[model samples]
Target: MLSAIREIGRLVVEQVINPAQSSGGKIITIVLDEANAALQEVGIEDFDPEKANRYLHTDRGSKGNAPAPFAPLTEAKKTLNKIRTWLSGCEKVIPKTAADCDLVNTINRALGLDDPILKAVDAAAGLLQKKDRKFLTVKLEGGKTFLGDYEVFRKAVAYFADRKAEKSCSTGCACSICGKIQEKVSARTLVYGFDTDDKPGFIAGGFDKTQNWRNIPVCSECRTFLTQGRKFIDSRLNFKFYGLNHCLIPQLLVGNADVLEDIINILSDSHKSVSLRHRIKRRLTDDENEILEFLSGSKDNMTLNFLFLQKSKSAERITLLIEDVFPSRIRAIFEARDHVDSVFSETYNFGKIRTFFSKSDPEKRSNDLNKYFLEIVDAVFRGKWIDFSFLTRFHMDVIRRGLVKDEYFAFRVGSVNLTV
Candidate 1:
């Protein structure tokens, strides 16, 4: 059946799809040839970036297994070939007739805004285009939480935030193009529930950089502090707020919008501007439609998606179930590990914690009436704990019977670990 589907797909591509001229193969070939030809085009002995890193007449240290110098000529030829091939193909696909001008202008005309305002708009747009970039981590913000895209962030704030005459530029992620040369850091930032907390404590951990800090981790106190504002900015410009999945927001530091706008306006002269209507629309609401439209226009520089999962609650239930039996016998023990760690920590700091067994009275006192049921209760709980295997099986049995009453309700436990 899979073979039949592939056969049909191939047939459609071969028949219905006209094979337009493509220099894809040539592009790959040129890329492959770039290393050999670099010297002729670039005027360097080789593209040894390390050697290039040195200033004029600077001393350099020699490392073992020095790589061969790169030839820059190959790279230049490769770029020229790529552009030529691309433009050739583009001309075929794009209409050359003046008859198409009105159709193009229809998209160009933003009802009331003039070319000057449009240029400013275009400049603002250019700021979001992330350039010379690697990884970026943005803390989740309430205003931008719904945005879920860096591309949108670049465009929305890159241009003038205030149209009122006295309004000024803010952060500087700008354009070199004069057309809006928008750029945004493409790195994903998140408030992970506890992606990696090196220190194990009451709540979860701080963001795990290795894991890209993706979830919301909150303590009991921090969770309670969320009611004060929709979004709050601290002196550090770090935004803290609630995000999706009822999680606390991560802190994202923004770039300089003022410089970013200046550069974008300069670099983005050739590019068209996003409309004032669009700008006003973006600034006015936090609705999904407007947010999506803003992101949709961004040229795929950054994309973000949020997934919802009930991790803490799930982990809690799993932990409780595993701790049901005394010293738990889940075979794949986890909470037992945490329990062992806890006990070790307690014993290690024994000198620091001598309170549990330290009652004010030198000798302990118990009522004679309590002595009767105490032993019986101990016996009942102890009978299940005498053997690990028997205890595990017994724990599972009691849980099954108790769960029949209600999924979350558990009646008995040898270790008194029952939630209900």
Candidate 2:
């Protein structure tokens, strides 16, 4: 999944999708048009309402309660403080090269203001308060976000990419992703719900928190791609799966990135996905629309990866991973399901299978039995063997529970038939 994500990130960085546009969310952007002009003065009169644009800025990182590196705005004052701090850092780090001079001067002028860009931020916040908006961002009128700036991104990468040097380590360490020893590596796991930074015990080597970089060491390039890959996943591939959340990732088979790019485009567009499903006569359960429908008519050059995950706050727990499922296998799964439905002369699908495993509680939420049900799902998709006696045991349990008036007898019988 991490490798696939890195590939997606590579594609994103290669301009398959503009990283700036793709990383953005539903943000109320306060465009500081004429920054040079704004820096010349310090008053509300200098702020322009025309510069404000409300569009979707899908920064998934900020959607959670955790503080992101360049977090979106919750309060105007805090946003200004971040801006000030960022500018100060940029001034100190951005080289005086001809290529960087313009951005450096902009940062310098923005910070040089006696009142600075406070008025613009205050006015922008005031405008946001009048309407309902989930996030706020300040950008220059040239259409580049602060985080989207090339220099800012480069600085960020350098700061993180050279962590080995920062820690005063002269020797190279092995990177978990590429399996190579490198002088520079990062401790940050771009994918959340995987390895968390807060847990020291989760570290691979020792309990020394400062030396945690050795655990799942990722190189700078891989780390960058992971970041972009996560953005793509969060914004596009994440979907609902039988009352759970899953990420549908595509892995290339023929060494052709174009095929993977096509898959990405298809999944990202609803109309294309529906059209593909219809062309292939694919049937889907209600929850399966986002999961199986899009791959119905895809080529055999790539396989699909389904990662069912549970995320709470900052930690994520993977529920199940059904990997390397080829398009041919998907077709086989559906064909088998259809054949069963036809033989029974009744509706049969995964949804019905799920009911047999569903909790009898009032809310019918997930419980310990979910793992067993997921195992069944994994087995079905992978064409793995299931013990006949185990199925009989479960079926008998359902029947006996119904007979004892624990559940409706007819419903249990129907459920048993659907699975059998």
Candidate 3:
């Protein structure tokens, strides 16, 4: 499992970062001019500016209008301190441009002041509140804001990874995932969001002493890989279905990155086009077909996996379902769907299919529907007959209770005809 997570991370990094580097662009650079301009706009004076790397970090408002500081202020300070440390350590590589010097001076000045950092934090917070902005990200050189760019953040993480590797291991034991004997296994935390209440769930180990990180014994390298991989997945491969809080993460092996991206794009676009009527549309659009065909054509040795996750009551993310299927299986599933569509295309115009799969409240219906839906898709892909008993019973109950009005009744009737 640790190997799989690490492999996923590697794939993500390759797909995301390699192309940027190949294009002759630096992964991240200090935008001295922009940072100086922003600081000047905020009315700071006479401080020699420091060149700072453009990186993503979060800041939030102080609590109410009270004079006392809040958690967001503390978080902002920590983030600034981290950036300052990183910058100070990399003085050799930092450009000696005028803007860079000014940025460094400004940072030093701010740090020296007892209340300037607080003032800046409050000013940014005020902008967020007055402008109704979602983020309080700092502006940097080149008019670009630090919007939490993963590539930039990865460098910081790499620095920490080196430090972590240097730590002495408490117990030298064989890693559970890699089978290598190593000292000092660490827990891997997968962070999905920024809320303080959002629990950082462990991928390899948990809070329980019996199931501690040491017990799982993942080496620091693997642990770092897992962290980076989760960050990439959360940023790029994750999508929400409708308004539900659940996320669908697609993992692909043996397929083109462009094709996988297209598939995810279709899913995201379809999600945005969902009707206001709360009806779930299962049919693929014309645009979706082109990409699917491209995906299907490259299925010689391709494998695809999906994870359906939702937040638990404790605000921790948990996988609700998982599906691992080959490209051939996906093609088979598409064929089966077409067959079903043909059977009902004339009488009900395939309306019954939607009715059979309708999910009004995703939170309540997702697990059962996702499980059974995948089961049916698998059965069809495997060239086996699908069981319609569950659908039949559900239709009968809806009719018996007259739970659906005329339009829905028509759909139920049309769906029943397809079952026969």
Whose lDDT is greatest here?
2
Tens-place lDDT digits, model 1, residues 40-123: 111111112122212110011111121111111122333333223322333343345553333223212321223343243233
Worst 10 residues of 1 by lDDT: 55-64
Residue-level error in angstroms, candidate 2, position 211: 4.8
How does candidate 1 score on lDDT? 0.24
Ten contiguous residues minimizing lDDT sum, candidate 3: 19-28
Candidate 2, 375-411: lDDT as tens digits: 8889987989988776777677667766777566786
- Winner on lDDT (1 vs 3): 3
Ranking by lDDT: 2, 3, 1
Residue 109 C-alpha lDDT in model 2: 63
Which residue runs does candidate 2 get wrong by more than 4 Å?
17-71, 88-134, 139-174, 179-183, 197-201, 209-211, 277-280, 291-301, 363-368, 392-409
- Residue 55 displacement (Å), model 1: 30
**Which candidate do you rate higher for lDDT, 1 or 2?**
2
Residue by residue across 1-420, what tens digits does model 3's lDDT show? 335446556554455332111111111112324433324332211111111122322111122221111112234455455445544543433456665455555644544442555465555555443323222223344434442332423343444444433332345777666678886554323223222211335322354433445534567666655655555445444544322223234455655666555544444343432431133333332121123333444454445444445555435443443445566765665676668668667432223443454453434645344444445434544556766686676567656545544434665566677654
Lowest lDDT 10-residue stretch of candidate 2:
47-56
Candidates in order, TM-scores: namely 0.14, 0.75, 0.55
lDDT values for all models: 0.24, 0.62, 0.42
Rank by TM-score, highest first.
2, 3, 1
